[model samples]
Target: MRRLIGAAVVGLGIELVVLPLWLLPRSPAWGLLLIPLTLLTTPFWSLLHEAIHGSLVRDRRANDAWGRVLAIGYGAPFALLKSGHLLHHRYSRTERERTEIYATGRWASHAPGYYLRLFGGLYLAEVASVLLALLPERGWAALVRRTDRPDTITGLLFDRVRRRFLTQFRLDASAVVAVHLAAFLAYGRYGWMLVAALAGRGLLISLADNAYHYGTRLDASLEALNLRLPRPLETFVLAFNLHSVHHRHPGLPWHELRTAFAADGDEFHDDWFAAVGKQLRGPLPAGTLIASSPGVRRH
Candidate 1:
């Protein structure tokens, strides 16, 4: 969580510092800063993503409790994210149900209008997804399974949050609306800074990550990476890009991913890259999908 907090501080502070500068009437410089700062949010969202998955916390509930705080900032539903992500882990490459690979031919990735969605104005996108996830008995049923632990905190966690969101948003459950509301109160047309810079950059990060990690590989384990980012870039994405180690030991928690990688750097450096070499841009290694760990069960 410390790593995530640090990234959030920087990612958000960049905006907080500039917003005040902009209140002084039209300043081109503030707008300029806003343009790129929005770009950085993609990475910011990436950091939030890993943190929500419990990597940031040594304790699961400790991680989970605060995960909602993160979700609230995004105006996102934790249940929605959890429902999809768990499905991704369960069936990373399966068709129709694959969140990673949108075989919907939407592969013509990121464009300008796509970026405008940072305005917190994209309606029905996520709502449709959450609803569709409930359409199949698989979707409805798996979502229900989360409630099996009635004796524990998970019950209150899922039901309360989900019910509150369901009642509040109804069919119009876009975090974008809250974003717009904040924008109206905060800065009018320019208030999009929060969404554009923060969420826009966030979407960029997700697309890049999705394509780099998911869009390319048909196989799950082969796509894993000890993704060593360049030094300065680490501040933007945090260490969350080091994805492979986390998968190897999901129970190991977030703080330990780097330590675990450090302990095995030599081995991953020597062999792991080539193992995943098939998924890269230029090179095409001829082979079937393979994961280094025989340990991960398909769910």
Candidate 2:
């Protein structure tokens, strides 16, 4: 409950603080303030992630409702994301499924360019996902059939899992549109800052997410890279820094993750920036990081 309140407060602060600061009559100081304010939205995205996993709340209906609201703030459809995310959990680290969670195409495996694309166009990737979700079911189906690929999030958005929750999808879409329209009206000429904030959110989200499982091999145990982050960030993102624990015990609530990790700490990686730095340099050693964990041999 306290974590939820913190997320709500920061999410609201993004609108109240960042938007107005960006709109304030041209000033270098206000521009500087916008940087951290925009980046501060990372936890809000984390809340959306918790909701997508259905671990944010105990009640199913309430969880889905909050998922929709958070998705609107992230500018993605809740139903679409929830569907893709379930598939991701089922097929993590595989060529066919990891793309749903991270942009792991051929280019993403190569040198410094991978990090460039990961951070530089993370928001554009979200925009593409939104556009894909907007396609009619049949239209999206046709596109998938033409490509003969089900590896990307855009392709996964065409999955049939969402058919059962079509109404929720529409509601999520409507909420996103309404939120954007309201922001536009409120910011007027400087409404573009809202769009910039969305991009900023995407960059931070991808950085944090990539830090989790970016360089793992397909056959790795648990298939996750748990980094050691600062105490404040770890608390703020609700222990997502311990990515392996969350993936291993997906049913655990955010607050419970730390206790769970303490019991099976050997199975997780805590190499700090090792994985991210290795991936940034070039291709990563498959499962090498995970192999270092006690009793967890690399496949």
Candidate 3:
């Protein structure tokens, strides 16, 4: 309940506080807002992200409910975001068992960097297609559900077409549309820039996320949320910055993370990069200077 309230308050605060500055009259300071807003956007995503993984809710349904709300915040059509993330958990920190899941800097020079960055960009796209083909759609509602999928039935990923349509809903998505509307009337041309800054914010979020949990497991309590990271970057990213710990203890809520970290047992902390390197063959799918042979792909 606290996290839910936090999400509502934080979401509104983001649009209210950050949007205005971006919409304000032209000034050199507007550029600075990008850095801050980029930072601001991280917590918003982290809180809701933790919520979706069931770490923030006592009841599983509540987790599902909030996850839907989070999806709306990101614009709903992201099937890969929901599914891809869960799949990463299913197969964590193994290069040979899972290709391209880890980014120890061992990627082939030939790998399509742009396309690969877009979620298991290769594997899950094929999975989504096969899933759509094979998964049963019962009844008429199911028949009409060009968007529905096994994940929706089991509450994994949101439906397929709904994900796309709702995600792509330009300003018409009721709550989100209202947001864009306010910015449009207020900032006019500059409103788009404010919105565009969120893109940079997403970049930051992804980078920090990779930095925090990079090739680690979240099978126990608070592991992902407790890993060490630079202190200066912590608050800008919010308390949930203790990512490995949070992944393990998903229900801890953003506010409780620090206390949880301090109170956690010996297992809660780790150097994320080093954890994966122990038995890892060669460099990770991404490469690291410490490996034996960078290109020696293991089977």
**Candidate 3, position 294, lDDT:** 33
Candidate 1 local Cα displacement, residue 12, angstroms? 4.3
RMSD of each: 8.7, 4.5, 8.8
Candidate 1 all-Cα RMSD: 8.7
Most accurate candidate by TM-score: 2
The lDDT for every candidate, in the order shown, is 0.46, 0.63, 0.46
lDDT tens digits, residues 1-299, model 3? 57454755665555545556543555645545456545565666665566656665777777656665554455332233455466455434433222324444434552455324322333223222323332333422354445443322222233433344333322223444454456556656566665566556555444444444433332221223244446655653456557655555655666676777677542334543443333232224433322333321121
Candidate 1: tens digits of C-alpha lDDT, residues 102-221: 322333352233333323323224423334323443543455576545222333434433554443333233443454355445655565554455555445433454333432345453
> What clash count goes with each model?
6, 0, 28
> To one decimal, what is the Cα RMSD in angstroms of model 2 from the true structure?
4.5
Compare candidates 2 and 3 on lDDT and give the better one. 2
Off by over 4 Å in 3: 1-34, 55-67, 77-84, 94-111, 114-186, 213-226, 230-239, 254-264, 267-299
Model 3, position 10: C-alpha lDDT score: 65
Model 1, residue 148: displacement in angstroms?
A: 20
Number of clashing residue pairs, candidate 2? 0
Give a tens-digit lDDT track for model 2, residues 156-268: 55544345665566666776667667766766666576667667877776655555666555634366656777778788777777778877888887788888878875344
**lDDT for 164 (candidate 3):** 47
Model 1 poorest ten-residue lDDT run: 279-288
